[model samples]
Target chain A: MIRPLAGMARVGLRFQLAYRSDVIMSVVALVAQVFLLRMIWTALYGGREHDPQGLTLEALLAYLSLANLQAFATTPIIPRIAHFRIRTGMVFFDLSRPTGYLPQMAAFQAGHTAGGLLMLAPAVPVVLLVGTITPTEHPIGYAATLALGYVISVMMSLLICVIGFWTLETAAISMLYRLVSHFFAGTMVPLSFFPGALGVLADALPFKYMGYVPAAVYVGHLSGGQIGQAVAVEVGWIAALAALLWAMWRRAHRRVVIQGG
Target chain B: MAEVVRTLRLYWRLQRAAMRGALQYRLNLVIGVATGVAYQGSGFAFVWVVMHTFPAIGGWSLREIAFLYGLRLTAHALYVLPFSSLIGLDWLVREGELDRVLLRPLNPLVQIMAKRLGVGQLGDLLAGLVLLVVALPPLGPASALFCLAAVVGGALVETAVSLALASLSLRTWNTIAVRVFADDLFSKFGSYPMSVFGGAAQWALTFVLPVAFVAYVPASVLLDRTGELNVPAPVAYASPLLGVALFALAYRIWSRQLRHYQSTGT
Candidate 1:
């Protein structure tokens, strides 16, 4: 199983790397995004400031910049690809395969993300310089949380993509995901800044664990016990999502009506 | 004159067919529209959260910013309504569907423009109108006409920028990322006033990408606060002309790129 997964990952990595233009474009897009965020935050934090929500100006800026950078690197294109395949009737080949569909697709996307992150490495320096941010207190701990965050994010995206099996309206599903995540995922603003009801809603969503928790841990907003709890939540969400995806895949695969060919 | 009439007739026929095909997926269309509403709702929620926390940022109140947001959103909806098919140019080029389009005895670009109707933009249109009504800036006949022209201009600018960026597909054979990058430049920055940005961003939004012309400048004119970003009143009033000029330039570039296109032999 590991061997097949690894092989699939390699194929994904190579396929992604071959699209040199996409790699370059992603880098350029990330840099432009960092600039945009810097402008917005800098303007927001003009002069007289008491750090709202217990965050210093520097910390808020750091989290905003870093969260955006991380989100940019981790955005999975597999759903879009899956949509295209399903629409073109090419998904039939993958569905007919004997391997566990989830593992194969996950490994493939993981590999693509690895390549994508490599291309996105320049964004780190850009963020550090523009945001004037520093390293977290516990580098290893931050890494662990970030890995979990990536897992949950990828799993959630896969769940969204699996909707293609039932309906080729995957773009709408993905757009809905994009729309909700902007508020719920704490990508656009810190979840702490959300008003009472909205704050509660953000906390309840799995998306916060994907972006907010990881950035918060890196920025020292979550420490020790808090970090532990966040990771546990992320893990729990991952498990729940995995089960949901399993059920969805079973149902969606049954309804797959191959078109074109 | 006869050629113009012929093109218009063809566009009308193409639009009807496109609408018919799109209506076939009734559920998807409904979901798409609902998704648009939800999308706009979240964006408005973000603005509400920000303004609620702070009275004003960059010397603009919530209502003022909403005026800006409304103008931009409605302008974008206007663009999406007629020309949303431009977003899918990369796919058409990649799959060689463009070849079949070229075989038709009409302007390939016009056919592309007429191919898909973005019915979902109706939701955005409604949302934008609601915001504009809420902002409720003082409106005289001249200002109202100015506002209407500004929205149309904003739409033209957006369409021009999208077309220009998407035309890269003619050479790269894949320009989805580039097109997305262009779209992001507007949606990300168009919400706020140009004064909020640094000197370089302000300059870019003014002369380079000109999203400032889309909403912020127009809003300033309506709100009676020109030169806030140092844009002259004359240029601010020329938003419609600017949009038309930019679109004309972008279309010229797109036409030139079309000559470079080689079929993928579907």
Candidate 2:
């Protein structure tokens, strides 16, 4: 399984590299978003030590930049693949393949993510030179939490994609998901920055574990124990979402087989 | 002149047919519209959160920033309602659909655009209109007229930008990334007053992309909120003219690309 997945990852990497312009365009868009967010936060900082939130200007800027970087670097491709497969009735072909559909998808995404990191390589220098990259007191805890957070992110995307089995207007489902996730994931704004009530709502949602917790962990916002708790919570979400996706995939596969579509 | 009028009439007929087809999917239409409103509302809500937390952003008050946001959204929806279908050029080109479009008697651009009206964007238009109406106190007649003209101008600039980038799909074989990038740029930047950005970025938005003319300059001139910037008084007041000029340039680019469009079969 590991060897085949590694091969699939290599294929995904090559495929991503072949689309040089897409990669370049994504990087360009990432830079533009970072610049736009940087300007807005700088303006909000208003040359003060910090707003009422107690975040130093540098700290806030650092958080904003890193959050965006993380998002761009780890953009989920499985949803897109699943979307295409379901839309074009290509899942029928996948079902007949020797490998398990879920593992194939996971391998493809792991590979694509590796390729996407190349696009983000240029931005790393920019973030380091200009951004406030907060290092956590507990590097090991941060790494573990970050990895777990990524698993939860992937599972969430898979669930959204698998939902296409039920709806012809899958784009709508994906768009709605994008809207909700971007808000709750702290891609648009840090979860900490949400108003008191909205902050509570964001915390309740699993989306924050996708982008916010990892960055928070890096920024020392989460203590060592809190990092452990965050990872545990993320693990719980991963298992729950994985189960949901499994049940969904089973029903969808049965439908495809029975309908012969 | 007669030819242009005739073309416009045909386009209107095509649009009406598309609308009837869209009406069949009533639920989808509702969802689309609601999604549009929700997306635009989120941006406004983000601004609200920011302004409520901090007194002002770049010296623009909440109401003033809301005005900018509302104008951009309204203009964006107006442009999208007619031309959003053009964003699908990548799919059309890839599927060899453009060959069929090229064989048609009508102008290819017009035919492509006339296939669908973004009825979903009506929600954005309504939301933006409500926000603008609420944000502005009763304006003088002249100011109101200017605001109306600005909305038209801004919409034209936006549609022109989409068309210009989409036209490149003929050569690039994929223009979706560019379209997405442009949308990201406009939505992220358009919500705020341009003066907040650094000098170079502000200049890029003004001259290179001309997005400032879409929302900021028009809002500034109409609201009498022009501040310490190097934008000349006359040029800032000529936003409508600027929009027209930018659109003309984009159309020229599209026209040039059309001539370069060789089918994959060819």
Candidate 3:
């Protein structure tokens, strides 16, 4: 099982690497985003060392750097793949595969993500040039939380992909999700910066676990006990999203419609 | 003159048919428009939060910044509404669809543009118009006319940029990434007062990318903040003409590049 999945993953990785222009452009976009965010935050700080919320200019820049990198690395390719497969009637092949369709898709996505990690090499220097990451004492905690965040992120993406079963046109839905998640997930702005009822709303959503929690952990924004609590919350959301996705996939499988076959 | 009018009429008919075809997927259309609105709205909301936290950026108040954002978005909508179809040129060229386009009787550029009407941009138009009306200060008749011209000019400037980039696809290169990056540069940098970015970056955005011409220069004129402009007042006032000139140049590039087109043998 592992060997077949590994082969699928390799195919996915090769598919990503074949798009040389896309990889270069993604690095360019990442650099530009990090630079722009750094500039904006610096200007916002107005030469002050720190803000009222205890977020220093250095810390904010570091958070933004990681957040943007995280965003670039985990951009939801699976949803797009699912949409394309459904629209072109190629999803039939996946359905007929001996391996579980979900696991195959997950393996492929994992491979694609590994390709994104490879592209990160070119971007790391650009990130360092803009800002320095605050050294965290709890590297183990950060890594564990980030792994959980990755799981939650994948589950969220798979859920969005499942929507393709119902509507072949998932472009708008995927775009809307990107925009919403980019903001609420704390890729664009830290949840700490969100004010009043908006902050409360962001906290309520699962998107925060995908971006904010791990980034916060990395920057040492969350205390020791808070990290434990955050990890617990991430685990809870992952289980919930998994169960929901399973139910939806079962229903979607029952009445699958191939569009252009 | 008569030939130009005939071409225009044909283009309009083609565009209308394309729009009708697009309307077949009503749910997708609705969601697309909503997505457009949500996208721009969230962007503005981010600025709003920032402004609330910090009093002002580069001496521009929230109202002034909002005006700048509105102008850029309105211009973006104007460009995207008609020319969004050009974004598919990379695919069209790769798949040999351009062969059919070349075989058509009408102008290839017009036919390419008529392939689709960007319905989602209507949402951008709505959002931008609201911001413009809300954030705009009282003005004389001439100033108001100037504002309208600026919006059109901004749209033209953006169109020229995209058209120039899309022309690269004629050489059989995938230009999607570069095109999207350019779009991002416009929306990201064009929203704020250029002064915040300091001298070097501001100059690059102006002379290099011409993002400054899209909204910053004209908005400065409208808001009576021209004193802080990097360029002379006349250059700012002539932004609309610059857009027209740039677009003509881009069209020339497109025509030249089209001569080099070779179809992918299927």
Q: Which of the numbered candidates is closest to the native, going by highest lDDT?
A: 3
Ranking by TM-score: 3, 2, 1
Worst 10 residues of 1 chain B by lDDT: B170-179
Encode model 2's per-residue lDDT on B1-266: one tens digit a residue.
98899889999999999999899999989888888888888778778766667888888889888888889988888888888788888888877788999898888889998878787788899889988888975689988888889999999888778888887898856768868888777778987888889899898988887788788888888767766554887777888887788789989998899889877763
Candidate 2: misplaced stretches above 4 Å? A97-99, A130-136, A246-253, A257-261, B89-105, B164-180, B252-266
- Order the candidates by DockQ, highest first: 3, 2, 1
Q: For residues A1-261, could you state the per-residue lDDT of candidate 2 as single tens digits? A: 677777778877877778978888877777677777778888888756635566666666776677777777666777777778777777777667777777777788778888888866876877655665656567787678778877777777777666766773466777777777777778657787788888899999987876788777777666767887898888888888888888898887666622334
TM-scores of all predicted structures: 0.89, 0.90, 0.95
List-wise, what DockQ does each model earn? 0.54, 0.56, 0.61
- Runs in model 1 lying further than 4 Å from the true structure: A81-98, A161-169, A242-260, B87-108, B163-177, B248-266
A74-123 per-residue lDDT for model 3 (tens digits): 77688889989988999998888888778888888899889878867877
Per-residue lDDT of model 1, residues A1-261, tens digit only: 689889889988887889978778767766776677666666676754587778877888788877877777777778887888889988787777777777878988999888887777766787678877897896766787888888988898888778777767689888888777656768768888888888898889887866788888889888899888887887898899889988898897778878885
User: What's the lDDT for all of these models?
Assistant: 0.82, 0.79, 0.87
Regarding lDDT, does 1 or 2 come out ahead?
1
Residue A34's C-alpha lDDT in candidate 1? Answer: 66
CA lDDT, candidate 1, residue A169 = 60
**In model 3 chain B, where is the ten-residue run with the lowest total lDDT?**
B50-59
Instruction: Give the winner by DockQ: 1 or 3.
Output: 3
Scored by Cα lDDT, where does model 3 land?
0.87
lDDT of 1 by residue, B199-261 (tens): 877998888887788898888888888868667789888878889999999999999999999
Top TM-score hit: 3
Give the number of colliding residue pairs in candidate 1.
0
